[model samples]
Target: MSRPFLKMNGLGNDFVVVEARSAPFRPSEAEARAIADRASGVGCDQIIGIEPSDRADAFMRIWNADGGEVSACGNATRCVGWLLLEASGRPSAAIETEAGLLQVARAEDAADGAKQVTVDMGVPGLDWRDIPLAEEMDTRGVELQVGPIDDPILHTPGCVSMGNPHVVFFVPDAEAAPVREVGPMIEHHLLFPERANVGFAQIKGRDRIRLRVWERGAGLTKACGTGACAALVAAARRGLTDRKATVEMDGGELVIEWRESDGHVLMTGPVAVEFTGTLKDRAA
Candidate 1:
């Protein structure tokens, strides 16, 4: 049966959202890869499946462009949240994922009529056990380095788990950082048993940061919402920045706030609906 789908983007991180609440739809790894291929099929950073949820408004299933199923995706969450809110004409919605429950709310719309969304990413996990490193160590400063031992280019990165694992490296300049070269190395490092999302962050100010991320299974994306949240938390924990900051990414900016009182991280950004179409086959 042909199924309808929506193509959406949060910042420049795009997604192909399939609504399967009533009609069941699940794509295998190879099928997901085919659909996510830019040249062959509907191109997107991740393929999102919106399913029925007993505990929340809907369940969000995420598959990276490589067809690997992951626990969470913050940009996809915001895009799905906006769709739910617009459909229900409500102010908020709850989404269930492999990571956990996420609370999302509608913010004031932009002048261009695009709706803004804020997601409660929950508290970050700072323990090595939570991040599931191969060995135990202090998450604030993990023992890892790259480049020559005498003069390492990246070293002592902070680790955190925002649904998924993340290792943030504070750099002198984000634009100049070797993201493509070093990101894969760190992601597959022996210490990170489950692999990790790598973030290169440059503190522009107490309230601003410039960041680029190499996402696990997805390689380098235009923007990574969870990476932005992780960067702000890691920056604040290291005394490099405040609890809240505007993270400037290659695609756009995201406002991330680590709430001191509740410890939940809030991410605010805009979502855009690029177009709509129908898929003749679930795999295609």
Candidate 2:
């Protein structure tokens, strides 16, 4: 049977959302890759499946463009959260994922009627074992370097887990950082046993930063919500930024705050409904 789907984006980090609450819709890895291919199917950074959950309002399953199932996706969470809120006419919703449960709520809408969402991403993981590096090391400054022995363009990056592993490099200029070239290398580096999302951040101020991310399995995208959160945490750990900051990405901006009281990361951003349709030839 053809499946109805919604296309949504949060700060240009787009998703193809499939509701599987009643019927199971488990796409094979190859099928997911095909669906995410820009030239072949409905292109998106990730594919999200909404299923029933006893612990939360819904269960969100994430599949990257490469068809690999991952534990977390913050931008997609905001998109799905808005959908749930709109459908239930409620102000908040809880979504379960492989990573954990997320509490999402509707914020004030934009002047143009654009919906806004805030997700409680929970506490970030700072321990070396939590980031799950190949070996134990100081997460604040992991022993990784790029470039020549005497001089390296990128080195001693801070590590954090915003549901997924990430290593953040504080660069002088995010635009000048060689994201496309060095990102893949760091993603596949041996230090990160589970691979990792690579973020290049430039601190503009204590409350502002510029970021570019090389998402694992998804390459470079317009924005990465979790990456932004991880960036803020890493920056704070390194004393480069405050607990809260506005992260500017290629797509737009996201407001991320690491709540000091609860130690949870709150990400607030705008979500857009691009379009909706059905998959004519459903994957079996």
lDDT of each residue in 33-88, candidate 1, tens digit only: 88889998888899999999999999999999989999999999999999999899
lDDT of 2: 0.94
User: Total clashes, candidate 2?
Assistant: 0
User: What lDDT score belongs to each candidate, Candidate 1 first?
Assistant: 0.93, 0.94
- Per-residue alpha-carbon lDDT of candidate 2 for residues 143-237, written as tens digits (9 for 90 to 100): 99999979998999999999999999999999999999999999999998899999999999999999999999999999999999999999998
Off by over 4 Å in 1: 111-113, 282-284
Which 10 successive residues of model 2 have the least lDDT summed? 275-284
Model 2 TM-score (2 dp): 0.98
C-alpha lDDT (0 to 100) for residue 12 of candidate 2: 93
RMSD (Cα, Å) of model 2 = 0.9
Residue 76 of model 1: what lDDT?
A: 96
- What TM-score would every model get versus the actual structure? 0.97, 0.98
How far in Å is the alpha carbon of 177 misplaced in model 2? Answer: 0.9
Residue 166 in candidate 1 has what lDDT? Answer: 97
Q: Model 2, residue 115: what's the lDDT?
A: 86
